[model samples]
Target: MKRPTTGRSRHSGGPNVGRPGFAWALPATIFFALFAIVPLIGVAVMSFTSWSGLGSPEFNGLDNWNKLLGDKVMMQSLWLSALLTLLGVVIQTPLSILLGVWAAGQQKNRAVLSAIYFIPLLLSSAAVSVLWRALLDPNFGIPGQLAGIFGGDGNLLGSQAGAIAVLTFVGAWQFTPLHTLLYQGAARSVPPVLYQAAEIDGAGTMRKFFSITLPQLRNTIVTSGILMVVGGLTTFDTVLILTKGGPGTDTTITPYYMYRKAFQSFDFGVGSAIALVLVVIATAISLIMVRATGYDKMNSAQEGI
Candidate 1:
């Protein structure tokens, strides 16, 4: 027999039934604060001080920043980084989109080809740079063998234009696979009904792609674009192994410049300043992109249908 509830009627669900509590997020928050936040704070503080590799830091106010502002090399490095990043976006985005859509098709051979295409992503940045370096060598490399195409001497690394072009091409070659994988996964998630409806409407492949598939992949495009922009901005390993910021600092993007200052020149203070600046810039750009693209709203691309 059930008694009538007089003082209070009970709720069927638990108080926190549908919501996650703070405990669920506590571990990740702690980990991020310990690693990312702590280091960022240290770098920010270190940027205001003067330190060689050996001594304790001495506060010098804005001296490091002032010096950086006046440095022509620093200014030029910013321009070069922007140019390389732009080149990467312009060249890789559309290519990845096309490859990803095609790779998402119901073809048996795609499995084999996708694996082969992803091999570059498996290789380390250092290894890829070294392989290309050897392959572009004047006397012993592919360039030398195809001297008619690369010019008689095949000295691609000896000039500014040639070195920049090589860097951009290698970057695109190595990273495009990653972006393609992003798009491929996104492409697969698109509902089949959309495509079926388009076919019934007599929409051809190109028409369906631009009208339906591209719209469905909008969020993924934004995500991939952010990754590309940030990765290109901080490119370091390939430059170190392939160009060494060489042909006389022509390829010295900011990350390599920071490495040169901190490791080679032992200017810890200046290095910290550069590192902090980069962090701020990258963070700000990411935030701007998210805000501008409506990514922060977290709305579904397929919301209407």
Candidate 2:
């Protein structure tokens, strides 16, 4: 038997009527639309045209996209970007997590350690590039001087492998500290009682880490991995200042490829297509990673609460 609601108890209105504080949503929505949604739409539209940065864009359908299929340089850039992402994820992720766990355990004198770890991230990428350039200079650079000492004529950043190594070194240096901070935060959030219980159960450090810490930090690891992957894919400034996509395109990533296409070759059509491809790849990979890590389920559980 349904009871009839009185005027004071109920009214004809939407669910949000009772929530008077939801007014903030409107402003956020407007901001997102203006900044994010509008720019994405513009990029999508621009990706289909041939604009010279001055003239009106003429729609060329899928010609730009088709050009991607046969572009050797673009293919090369894609390969390098993929390699960078792979190396970053493989090298940085576990190291960051381990260091983060260690950092969390260091209750005393952590400030000094934190400052040391954060120095790389604190420096600008351009500054790091300039520094590394001087260090790796062929004639009078530290590395070259070291090679001279060793009687081995070696030039870092002169070969393809060297360039890749330099790029990876720069990336890991800047990003690992931030990633460690992420894991450190996550590790600290873990309940102390969990460790006590594990200790009582005779669980060793390795066992506890695998059965407890790793499981608890699954989300942070995924987030850090995604960031590393995205940064690897879109990295341009360091590579630009360091190698200029040179020594025969050894260090060229997709973003650098896009820059060369648009500004160097004056091919806006192809550049936009590459940009769109980058967007799609980044979006798809991020979604896949989030889904794989069960982040959506976690969000859903939080929402249900």
Candidate 3:
């Protein structure tokens, strides 16, 4: 049986009543509509048109999309994007979790090591890309032994497999710290009492981690995952600076391909179409992740107890 709410309504959200109202979000909502929605709508419209940057756009129906359908590079780009994003998630998640959990501990030199780990995250994307490019250069940066291990002459950007490996490694190198920071904050927030109780139950480190730490970090994991997926799909500067979609479109992910079509090839229509496709794919993936993980409806892990 449902009881009538007296002090405040059941819903703790939305406008009016005893809670923060719609006005609180109105400004941000309007800003988003104006900038994000308006620009997206314009891009959608432009996707169905033919235009270079010099002149007014002219409606061209679905020609742009039709071209994408027949483009092998476009298909390959999508696959590359998916592959890199998957690899990033697979590699970063556990590593970040471990590093973050460790950083949250009272271990010696944790502060110094954590600071070092965070350095890559501070540099701009272009800077990281250029740094890697020089470091991976066969003649100059990478040591001969490491170079041989990487790709014979260490020309990582020269071959599809090596290029893909470099991108994956670089992506993980730069972004792992960001996700680790998220997990660190979350891990720190977890009540020490939980661990104390687990210890009393004869639980080991692995047991406590699996039973308590991981479960408590569910929301943080989902948030970090979403960021990784979105960032991977939209990654461009690294591909441009490091590989240049090079060695015959081998490392050309969707975003880089879109850049080439729009700015390099001067095919604005096709580029706009690709951009819209990327937006749709990213949006769908994020929404699906949120829904599947129950992130949208989830309360704090320790809410009731």
User: Across residues 1-305, which tens digit of lDDT does each residue of candidate 3 receive?
Assistant: 33333334446552324644456678999999999999899889999999888879999999999999999999999999999999999999999999999898877799789889999999999999999898887678674447545546656677788889899999999999999999999999999999999999999999999999999999899889999999999999999999998789998999999999999988999999999999898889889787867766666554332
Cα lDDT of all candidates, in order? Answer: 0.89, 0.84, 0.89
Candidate 3, superposed: residue stretches over 4 Å from native: 1-34, 143-151, 288-305
Write down the lDDT that model 1 would get: 0.89
Better of 1 and 2 by TM-score: 1
Candidate ordering by TM-score (highest first) = 1, 3, 2
What TM value does model 1 have?
A: 0.86
> Of the pair 2 and 3, which is ahead by lDDT?
3
Worst 10 residues of 3 by lDDT: 1-10
lDDT of 1 by residue, 230-258 (tens): 99999999999999998899999999999
For model 2, how does the per-residue alpha-carbon lDDT over 103-199 read when each residue is reduced to its tens digit? 8875676757976898888888899889888877778887766774634555777788878888888788888999999999999999999999999
What lDDT is reached at residue 265 by model 1? Answer: 95
